[model samples]
Target: MNQVIRNTALSAAISLSLLGTARADDAKDIDTVVVTANRSAVPADEVLASVTVIERSDIEASQAPDLLSLLARQAGMDLVRTGGPGQTNTLFLRGGIASHTLVLIDGIRVNSANQGNFDFAHLPLSQIERIEIVRGPRAALWGSDAIGGVIHIFTRDPSAGYIEARAGSYGLGGLNAGFGTAHVAIGAGFETQRGFSATNPAAGPGSYDPDNDGYTNRNLSLRVHGDVGTQHVALTGLITDADVEFDIGETAAINRELGIVLWGEINDRWSHSITLGHNSEDLNTPDFDSHFGSERSTLDWVNTFTLNADNTLNLGANWAHETGFSESSTEVSFDEGRRNLAVFASWRGHFGTQTFELSARRDDNSQFDGATTGNAAWGLDVNDSLRVRASWGQGFRAPNFNELYYPGFFGFFAGNPDLRPERSISQEIGVDWLATLSQRVSVSLYRTRVRDLIAFTSPTFGAENVNRAAIDGAELDYHFEHGAFRLDGNATWQDARNALTDLPLLRRPDRKLSLSGSYRFSNDAALGLDASAYSSRPDIGGDLPGYARFDLRGSLPLTAGWTLEARIENVFDREYQLLEGYNTPGRSGVVNLRWNGK
Candidate 1:
C-alpha cells in the first residue's frame, strides 16, 4: 500500500509541476465544441464531464502508427494487443472492461454484437479528423454499453487536397490521398507492414511462432454536406479491409459504417436532427475454418429547445436492430437478431453562478428486461479563473450474442442463455483553473461500482453474472503554450479490482503518465517529443513489468505545398510486452513526403 501511494504521489507531482512552471502568454479560451458529451453540441468547458479532444494538429504532431498507439497515451486508458498490427486489440477506459466503452463513427455504433467490443487494430489514423473521449458513465444519454464512457471518431473533412507516401523499417510502406471541394470530400489510404513474431516460446510451445507476421489494410472515407433552404444535410461513409497473417493461418476482416444526418431549425427556440446509420463487420479465419459477422442498423431523433440564454432542454429517441452470425467447418454455430428502443431527455438550468443538469433514459430490449438510467450534474463558476463540477450517473450493458446462445467450444466453454445484464453507478468531481490565458490545469476524482459482471468460471465454463468490480481513480491535466512552444501533460492513478476477490483487474495498470511537447520554427517547420509510462499490471501468466517509451517527431517545409515529415519511435528501444506472450515493436523510423494543393 505504501508503494502504491508513493507512486501515485510521484505521478501527481510530475503533472502538477508543469502547471507551476509554465510561462506562457496571450492564451485564449479555445471554446472547443463537443457532441458526445450530451448528444448535442456543447462547449467543452461548459460540459460537466472529463473530456479529451484530439484534433488533427495533435494527430499529425505525434505521427502515431495506429489508433491503438495513439489512444494509449491518453489518461484513463489502457490497451492490450495479442500480437503486432492487425491482431486482436482491446481498449479499456477508466479501468472498465473492453465492452464497457462504447465507440462511435460519425454517430454510428460500430461494436460487434458477437463480442460487444470494437477492435482498434484495423483503424488507421489517415481517415480520422478528430476524436472525442468522454470518461465516466454516459448511459443517461446513450442506451447501453457506456459504463466506461464514449469515444466518437469523426471522419476526415479535408479542407485542401493532399497526397502523401511513407516508408519505414520492418518493410513498412503506405500511401494516402485526399481532396475536398464545396460539397464533398474523399480520402483513401493503403498500408502494409512486415511485423515480427507475435508470440514468445517462453509462454508455452503452443504460443511459439518463429515465422514473421504481416498486416495489410485498405481504407476509404467520404463526406458530403449541403444546405437546402433552412435544413442542413450530410452523408458520411467509411470502410476498411484488412488481412492479417499469424502462426497457424491468416484472418481477413472488413469494417464499414455509413450515416445520413439532417438537422433544421423548427422555430426561434426549437431545433431537431435525425440520423440514420448502419455499421457492419465481417471476419474470416481459414485456419479455424470459422466465419463470423455482425451488423447494426440504427435511427436517432433529437430535439433541442433553447428556453433562454442559460437554460435548455433536449429530448431524444433511439432505435436499433442488430444481428450476429457465426459458422464453423461443418455446421452453423449461431444466427440471432435483436431489437432495442430507447427514449431519453435532459434539462439544463443556470441560476446565478450555478449550473444544473438532469437526464434520464429508458431502454427496452427484445431479449432482456427494460433498463432505466439517469444522471445529475452540478457546476459552479467560483470565480473568473476557477470552476468546479460534480456528476453522478447510472449505466448498464446487456449480454452479447456470444454470451447468450453460442454453442460449446471444444466442449470446454459454452454460452448461458439465462444471463443478466451488468449495471453500474459512477460519481466524479472536478476542478478547472485557468491560471493564465495560455496556461490551464484541471483535476478530477471518480469512483465506479459495477455489479453482476459476467464471467466464465468453475466446472462448467459457462458465462454467469456472478462477479463484481470497483474502481477508484484520479486524473490531472495541464496545458501550456508560449510563443512557438507548447507543452501538455497528464497523470492517472486508478485502483481497479475484482470486488469479491479483491485482486487487481487483469491487464490494467494502476498508474499512468504522459508528457508531450512541441516547437515550431519560423520557417513553418516543427519538432515534437512524446513520452509515456505505466505501472506493472497483473495478467493470466503473471505480472507484466512496467515500461516507458518515447518518440521523436518533426516536420520540415521543402517548398511551396511540399513538406517532409518523420518520426523515430521507441527512442530507447526498451524491450517490453503488452501481453503475456506478445512481442512489441523495437526502435524504428518512418519518413513521409507530403504535397498539398489549394
Candidate 2:
C-alpha cells in the first residue's frame, strides 16, 4: 500500500507532452460544442474527456430550484451542506476536495480567491442558458484548480420575450421576465422561500437553537451583442441581492458579475477572442455582526489557428487579480490580495481513427513562484458506434487566503505562512457506446492522488500540510429517449482513503445511485420523476446513515402561449442529514405559470 501511494504521487508530476496519433475534428459533427474540455470548442464525441451538457431545455424540464439540486444527480458529483436551502454548501467532484474544482461564468472565473469555493445556493437558474461540465484534470490548459474538473456556466441570451411566475409550499414564490430584440436582451427576477429550521439538534443555553430559517432574493441579468464591421462584440451583466435567515443568524448579501467579449477573424486561418470580466460578493450577518467580501477581475485573450483541415493550434494568455476581506467582529479583521499571470498552448491532430491532444501551461503568481505543467490525451474510434479515450493530467491549487494569512481571528485556528500549494495527478479511461439512435451508455474508471493536503489541527494550533489522499472511483451513466419517453440514470462507487492513516475520507459516500425519467403527452404536457439512494458516509467523528429521496414534476399547457408547471420534492418525506447537526427539507412543492411571446 505504501508503494502504491508513492507511485500515484509520482504519476502526478510526470512531465508529459506525448503528441499522440489521430485527426482533429470540431463540434460541427456532433452539434454540441464543449469548451471546458479543452479550453476551445470541440465536439463532445471527439474529446478525450468525460463531459455532461445541460441545456436550457433540460433546466426547465428538471424544475431544479438551484444549481446544487441539479448537479447532485450527475455522476461523480456530491454535495456536502450544513443545513437546508440557503445554507453553506460544498461540492466534491470525482473524489477531489471542494477546492479542486474550478467554476467559470462565461469564461470568467467565479470562485472566491480567498475562500477557494463558490456559493451554489444563490445562483439564479432563470439567468442561465447552459452548463458544460468537463470531468477530470485539465490544469495543463486551464491553469490551477483543475484537479477534479471544471464547470462552465453560460448566461441566457434570450431573443424571445417571456414572463414567468411561481408559488407553492413554504411560502415559495418568484417572478421573472425577459425582453429582447435581435441583438439585445434584458432579464430580471425575484424569488423567496419561507424555509424550515436549518438545524434541529437539541439546544442547551445558547449552544443550539431551532427556528424557521427563511430566504429571499432578487436578481437582474442582461446580454447585448452586435456586429461591428467584420468583428463581433458582446456584453453581459448579472446582479443578485439576497436576505437569508439561517439556524442562528440573518445575513444580507449581494453579488455582481459583468463581462465583455470581442471576437473576429484576423485572417483565413486565424481567429481571436478576448474577454474581460469582474465579479464581487459582499455579505453581512446581522445576528452575528460579521461581514465578508471578495472581488476578482480577469482578462484573457485566445487565438485559434487552423493549421489545416485536420489540425489546429490554440494559444492563450490570462491575467487575474483578486482581493478580499473578512471580519467576524470588530476586533478580528483581515484583508488580503493576490495576482496571477499565465500563458498556454495546445495542439489537436489525429491519425485516421485515433485522435490526440497536447497542452502545456506556465503560471506566475505574485504570492508564489512560477510553475509549468502539461498533459497528453489520446482517443480511438473503434467504429461508428464506439469510442474509447484515456488521459493523464497534472493540477495544483494555491493556498487560499484563510490558509496562508488568517490570524486566527475567531479562535483556536491559525494560518501557516509557509504552507505550500496542493498538487495532484489524475488518470482516467472511458468507453462510450451508442447502442442505438435513441439510447447511449458511458462508463469511466478513474484514480486520483492529492498530496500536501492542508488539515487544521485542534487544541489552539495552526493549519499544516500533513495529509494525503488516494481516490479511486467508477461511474456508469445511461440515457434513453424513445417516442415520448425519456430516461436517464447513473451510479457511482468510490474508495477515498487517507494515505497516512489509511482511513476513509470524511463526509464522502462510498456508493451513490440516481435516476430520472419523464413521459410526454400529446397535449403538450409532461410528467417526470427523480429518485436517489446513497450508502453510509463518514463524518467528522461518526457516520451518517444512508437514505433515499424521491421527487415528481408535471407540466401542462394552459392556453395559447401559456403553460403551467408543478413539482413535489421529497415525495417520500425521508428524514436524512447531509451534515451531523443539520436538517434536510421534508415534503415540499411549487407551481409555476409561464407565457411565451414569440
Candidate 1: residue pairs that collide = 27-437
Off by more than 4 A, model 1: 1-31
**Model 1 C-alpha lDDT per residue in residues 456-537, reported as the tens digit of each score:** 9878788999999999999998999999999999999999999999999999989999999999999989999999999999
lDDT of 2 by residue, 1-598 (tens): 1232212111111101011111232323223556667765566667788889888779989998788999999999989877766788889998888889988887778887767887878888888877878889888888878889998887876568788899988788899999888767888999998877777653234535677788898989877776678666678888989888876678898888898876656777777777888999888996887788889998888887778877889898999998888787655567888899999999998799998999999999988786688888898999999999998888898888878878874676888878888888888899999888788899999999999898897666688888899999999989999999999999999999998999999888999999999999999799999999999999976899999999999999888789899999999899998887788888999998988776
Q: What TM-score against the true fold does each predicted structure earn? A: 0.94, 0.93
lDDT of prediction 2:
0.81
Worst 10 residues of 2 by lDDT: 12-21
Q: In model 2, which runs have C-alpha deviations exceeding 4 angstroms?
A: 1-31, 202-207, 328-332
Cα displacement (Å) at residue 240, model 1? 0.2
- The clash count of every prediction, one per candidate, is 1, 5
